[model samples]
Target chain A: MSAEVFEPYQVFVRRDALDAMEHVGTVMAASPEMAVLVARQNFLRRDAAVGLWVVADADMHSANTDPQFFAEELDKSYRRVDGYSDNARRWKRFKQQALQLQDIVRDLESKEG
Target chain B: MAQDDKAARGPSVAEGAALVDLLLQMADDDLVLGHRHSEWLGVAPDIEEDVAFSSIAQDEVGHAALYYELASQLGAGDADRLAFDRPVGERRSAAFVELENGDWARTAMRHFLYDAFEEVRLDACTRSGWQPLQRAATKVRREEFYHRLHSRTQLHHLAKAGGEAFARLEHALADLWPYVASLFDLGPHAAELRATGVLPADAAALRSAWEAVVVPELSELGFGVPACGGTDATSAAHRGAHHPALAELLTTMRAVLDVDAAAASW
Candidate 1:
């Protein structure tokens, strides 16, 4: 069995750490854990590092930046609790009225039986 | 890191030219030296060492960039033109930076010796109280920390690994010792810099401080500390008669830049 010889700046890090710092750093690491230290020196020199991660510079994939990917088809307000909120307690009042109707129906069914 | 009012003192137009000359000299030294070290990018003996040495080289270049920028504000020239377009004879970096890379062991020894002088020069600059220059030295110090670390590690490694074979390294050290000592050669600005409160220690005291660091380290490396034979020994490089290798370096570095000097864009 054989592994490729490591390059000069190449380093190994643990796997989990890769997911942690994906957007935050440029760590050309062989392992995820080692990437954290390298990333600290490269980007966080003047800042504090809460945690770090690395991925192989080669293995990681990125889309060929298409402008279409960024275009919005419709308002994304449905995802926002504030934007989509029903005012006048509409949804809550509806739920209460529905429950009351269901209780009346059950009472009527019991009388019929 | 803010500039002091004193640092803002302007010389007469003639004096401005003179100071600019001196500043350019100091800046160019770091630039040329950085280029030499950068050539070792792929070939450093160990993998970790390659990264470490490359970082030091980059730091040296960054220091040069800072100096050049300072000179530009003073109307010497932009940093790029000053760094690239000068002739060998007209150029003013020290001879220590001009020497070619020999072998890894010798390179480390030279670097070990170089760091001692750099740290002292920087310390002298730090206390200069010329706020802008002081800030520059402080920023450079942050990077020097790594340079010294890598140099010390490499020195220790070679000293132990090579044993008797380390003589080549010693010879390189001995040759560079006097030249390296010259880095602390405070120029005519000694009095001016002091009067401006730009330098706390005179050049001599700075050299002593440099020796204090270098002596113990050299001893550990199995190399004896070299002494300056005379005043001439300490001050020769400022005259700019550099190592022979400097000519070839200048030629190669300027080859592309010299072609389009008057062109509006690169």
Candidate 2:
């Protein structure tokens, strides 16, 4: 898939799911200086991995594991647009809008049929 | 409801068996046809077309297997035997699925025709009251969306390119047309299945729906629509013989299955 030097990992990072902050994924490194080059030779032997994650999965903790943490499930909701009740009204409204859109599509299909 | 009829109600064990029986026919149609299509892997006229076609072939075969698994659950037969071991005539696939890939045009024509039928058929099936069949039909309908798009994409490009590609497609459609009609062939379940709501529409209605949707699209794209009128049914050259390519396809499809009939993992 990659014969022409297109920076395979950069291509990979775009196609793959990643976040600077979410769940930790595969992390690889040497020193800050040689890390990129070291990762390239080791992981890119075959065009396998596109990008590298520096953190380990175990190192990551969810609120449930954080023990006294999950103390504010309600608090995180504000951080998420979805978790906000005010947005819930919008979500419900949008959901109905999507259904109406779906019916319109079905109507078009029936006419086409 | 009568004694000695061996009939069924909704999705009970008996109904599941009956459902599976109907479903196997659908599944095998795609599976065997997909295997035949896959033979074209890497040999298509160009690389991009090859990737696109292979993706389609794989989807068809995979969907076929999914259908067989549903039948298997109803205790009809395992997917392997349902696919490979049956005698040819025992198969219920319409003649269209069995026809050769022909040239690219032929393949496109067959593809165009089959996708039209399948989309409508799946849509009707999704409306069925039986839950499992309904859910399965819904899934197949979603996959068919992509297949339909792929077929038309090639059809548009081939008709536009208009050279060897056009010729191959046209020839494929003409030779494939007669058997393609066999896709609407009605068998024993015409009344009972329709009565029980096993299928939302009969084969005849499906054929009409197909012609309406498909002919217009092809005509728009500059391909000829085979005559749908004026022929008496009995006189209609309805007999379908196995094209030579089909035999080769069966051999290849069963090659792995034939080794150690006891090997069940496939």
CAPRI class of candidate 2: incorrect
**Candidate 1 chain B, which ten residues in sequence have the lowest lDDT sum?**
B228-237
TM-score of chain A of 2: 0.27
The segments of candidate 2 whose C-alpha lies over 4 angstroms from its true place after superposition are A1-113, B1-18, B229-245
The 0-to-1 C-alpha lDDT of every candidate, in the order given, reads 0.67, 0.65
Per-residue lDDT tens digits of candidate 2, residues B114-162? 8888887787788775656777889878878767876666577567767
TM-score of each: 0.71, 0.64
Per-candidate DockQ vs. reference: 0.06, 0.01
Question: On a 0 to 100 scale, what is the lDDT of residue B262 in model 1?
Answer: 72
State the lDDT of candidate 1 residue by residue for B127-192, as single tens digits.
755466778888888778767765776577557656554777777776676676446555656666
Candidate 1 docking category? incorrect
- Report clash pairs, candidate 1: A13-A31, A13-A32, A13-A33, A13-A34, A14-A32, A14-A33, A17-A53, B128-B197, B128-B198, B128-B199
